[model samples]
Target chain A: MDHNWDFASVLANKTLLLIGLKNTLVLGSVCLALGLFFGLFVGAARFSGKSWLYYPATAFVELFRNTPVLVQIMWFFFAFPIIAPFKIDAFTAATLGLTLNTVAFSSEIYRAGLQSIHKGQWEAGKALGMSYWQQMRRVVLPQAVRRMLPAFMNRAVELFKMTSLASVIAYGELMYQAKVVSTISFNPIEMYTSVALIFFLVLFPATILVRRFEARDTFRR
Target chain B: MTEVLRIEGLHKSFAELEVLKGIDLSVNKGETVVLLGASGSGKSTLLRCVNFMEIPTSGRIHLEGKAIGSARNGRVAYAERELTQLRSRVGMVFQHFNLFPHMTALENVMEGPRTVLKCDSSECRRRGEKYLDKVGLGWKADAYPSQLSGGQQQRIAIARALAMEPEIMLFDEATSALDPELVGEVLETMKELAEEGMTMLIVTHELGFAYTVADKVLFLSEGSILEQGTPAEVLTYPRQDATKNFLRGHNMFRLPEPQID
Candidate 1:
């Protein structure tokens, strides 16, 4: 059987893909921001030395990181409605699932970064008369952020790819729109290729930006 | 002269080893004291205990006659914050020259005054510049630690410590990390400070420099003070066998002629 490439069919779904692309951007941006906030809390708490603060945060990170994201999306979509009386939409569920996953991974990244800092840094801060909080904020966090640069970016890339799984929750993002167009037009190659291109467009610059940041930091050193 | 620093019944241990066994040291105001010791003699550990950088196993340390950084007579007199506040009065310069890598030389000097002392920006900057110049690093104000020589970095570290305007300063092998050719510059800077009446306790192997600048020279061996006296007395007329042995072993003191056999 000869394969006929349908350029027009792919082009016709541009509007759908544009809307999907917009949704994907919104989802990734929100998840990244909220994930960082939650992740910082989790990461800082894990090292806070208080058992009560660390243990529950550790459990949350482990539960999210160990399980599959598809199951998490399903739990949020199908199971959360059962446990809670509030009716939630697919996008909300997808956003929540993605945010939780990002938090788990980012917290681990932060913990490793924080641990890599020389104990001397803390001592130097303390010796300079900095309070414990000041030591962590002014001295520890800046050094840790620099040390975690590569890992932080890699996690963002991972989160970007993971957004593809949001399709399972019927979030109407890029992957879901790609599936709909390919099924209707029967042009899997063209539609999927276009989908891959859209992803590259969204993720490629972020990777470059993160790399630039790493480069600038290294150069500073 | 009144005492600026006094340590009594100071002891420190790690696991099975006792590093400092009841070290009692005192430095009068405006006096320069040099601690001489071989490797693993616990001179550095003694300095750490002075600033509460390493919590002593048990001890009493007084700074300017005030019970600070450690306890006295069974009561916990200083909390962590108060101990930190006390540390601001006693600056320390390390052998490795622990300047923050991200900060400029001037910024490193300014950090203590700005962050700890809460000095206004103009005053901090002015004092930073003066100290940097005093240490002969006036031109390297904007350079990072990586850009400076080992000696230059140590000088910057000294400047950073001095910017705190501390009443007492501790030098833990300050010039030990520098090139032999570069060591003289830092020692000269420190000697000048000593002449200016800066109370200092220096742990060093530079016996000649120690002899020239220190009012009192202390020889530590096996985690205890083996000998201490004026430099002429300690270097020229050592009374202890251990001091004589250490000097001879390190080629610091000339050995007597061996009988021809």
Candidate 2:
């Protein structure tokens, strides 16, 4: 069957798509910021020589990394309400699920950056009488940050794409809104086509930004 | 005068191999002691043990008559906090010049003062600039380690160590990694330091620099000091077989003519 496409139906409901698109971007960015913040601590603790800090951090990273995001989202959406001290809506559950997943991957990236530093750097810090944490904060981590930037940008893109999985929990993000539009319009192909267009519009510039940041730090690296 | 540094029965072993035997040495105040040896002769190992960098298997090290790593119930005991303070007093320069790549030359010099000493920025920066100029790197203070040449980096490393105002400086083949031409500039700075009465222990193969600068010369062989004396006594005279052989290898075994009245 030769199909004649109509985007006007999707455009007529542009407000719904735009709102869902905002939800997607906001959730992705919030998750990213929190994930990166928590991930650095997890990564640093994972690299800690002390057993007490290392084991718990390892468990956190492994539990999130090994499970599928869909399973996690469902678990949070259903189970977290019962387990948590207070009731949480699907929006909070989805945000938490996305953040948990991103933290696990990002923590590993941070660990990779930490280990990329040379052993002599630590010794140099010691020779200068800088304490252990001072070495990390002042010497090793500064160099590691440069090494991890490309990996971090990659994670941002990955998390943005993964936000689509929030649809499973009936979260009002881009994918969930698209399903609503398609069901009502009864034109799955056209509605989904516009959804794809909106996603591309948001992510393309983001990818370009990552590339520019990488190029700027090329000589420094 | 009391010795500024003393090592007694210092022994270091890695697995089955003993890298440094029961070594004994002493460095008096304002003296520059030079260590000469072939590769694997333990000159570097002996120097490292001074600041407990290598953690000698068994030894007693004293700085100005104060024993490092206090003995507790016949066992050597060290508190890490105290050790860090002690190490800062003993500055070191490496052959590869391990400068912090992200920091400028001035920043590298100021790091010790700022972080360890907790000096204010104004004091640290002023002292850093003074040391940079001391090393003839005043114009290059803002340059990163990668931006500088090998010799310049090594000098910056020296200036970094000097900023700590260490009581004794250890140079582990400081000029070995420099270009032949660049070597002179670093050696000149070190010579000036020695002349200014900075007690130093140097492990190097630069015979000319050693001949010109050593207050005492020690020849190490097979993890032990084989010969040691004034440079005139050790370098220009026939001594042990190991010392003679090492000098002969460098084609420098000729002793001065005997004086006749």
Candidate 3:
């Protein structure tokens, strides 16, 4: 097998790759912020004893968690536009799918974190004359958030990787740009390798940070 | 003497099991009432009812002559806001000394004033320091609950309750979870509080503490008060055989007088 590695073509398309990288960051961060913000409420609903809140939250979580992420994105892109009240662009479709997916996964983390706190903490708050929201915000969340950090960092890493799946819908993210460059350059090996290297360079630091948090948590325990 | 707390026909039931059949009690201002009974007795339940921590199945509780919950059908209905207000006035110290582990001792003491009373931070801090000093824990204010001993943590919990300036304090076996050697310090703090004329309702197995500090004593059997009188009358000479048996089991038929410095 005679093969020669050529990096010139891939290096020449740095501008396009940079654009792809920018789009990936934008999508990843937006989804992360929205997902985490909404995830807290959903998690609280699921943790609530009220059937009215618990049932709907449970249904939403199960619907997203049980299905595949690729399928969710595709449904939003290909199937949703027919019934959607507004125009569903590639970015819109991808954002909706990934954000909801992250919400569903991260909500369970929040629920477990909230549940890990002893019931006595709530009783203590109540015994001090704190209202329900006051107890949750002051006493419960401060403690629970510390335990939930590593899990949330892991979710962020997973979410960044999930952004690559938007290529299936031609969203022009990193993976999608790699496909276009490879097809035109006729160098699948070089283009795909660069994409893989890009992802690794970005995510490795976050993975290390998560590991550090988990270590500290274990030691504290 | 003015009544600080009063309970009329307080009944509590958990599903099919009834904890308190019917209870009628009153605590005057600056009075210390001690409750003594076996494990299955309804002493803890009665304390919880005063703060609306355990909603009565059917009964009424009055704090300073004001009824707590509204009557709905045969049971009492509580509003969350009202319960929160009631708890602020009636502080409780639990067996486990449930201090917020994340907060420092001073912060734990300050939390009630800051959040519930909406006091300024400086004012809260001032009150926090005062109560911590009252409990003889002024030097340990910066320490967390985990760093403190069981007795020290219980003292901080007492400070936390006291910072709210409650009208009455309820102790549900407050010293039960402390180590035997550590129990002295906590009991000593409680004795100081009693000497200061704070209204208190205590549930404990320490007959010595009751003998020395209690203004009145009540012995509970099953779910009703079997005997009620002065400590000398109830602890030393009980008319009820059940109270006598419980006292004998504790080996406290004749409690030695507690030494106070």
When sorted by TM-score, best at the front, the candidate numbers are: 3, 1, 2
The C-alpha local distance difference test score for the whole of candidate 3 amounts to: 0.93
- Each prediction's RMSD over C-alphas, in Å, is 3.9, 4.0, 2.2
A1-221, model 2: which lDDT tens digit per residue? 78988888888888998889999999999999999999988998888767998999999999999999989999999988887899888789988999988889999999889988988788788877777888899999988998788789988988988898999889899999999988998878998888888888888888898888787853253
TM-score of each: 0.92, 0.90, 0.96
lDDT of 3 at A153: 99
TM-score of chain B of 1: 0.93
By DockQ, the best candidate is: 1
**Candidate 1 Cα errors over 4 Å, as ranges:** A48-59, A217-221, B69-77, B252-261
lDDT of 1 at A133: 82
Q: How far in Å is the alpha carbon of A180 misplaced in model 2?
A: 1.5
Q: Estimate, for each residue in A24-122, the C-alpha lDDT of model 1 and write its tens digit.
A: 878888888889889988988887779998999899999999999888988999999888889989888988898999898898888888888788777
Candidate 2 lDDT score at position B257: 78
Query: Taking the candidates in order, what DockQ does each have?
Result: 0.58, 0.52, 0.56
lDDT of 2 at B118: 90
- Of the two candidates 1 and 2, the one with more favorable lDDT, higher being better, is 2
Candidate 3 docks at the CAPRI level of medium
- Candidate 1 CAPRI-style tier: medium
Q: Which sequence of candidate numbers ranks them by DockQ, best first?
A: 1, 3, 2
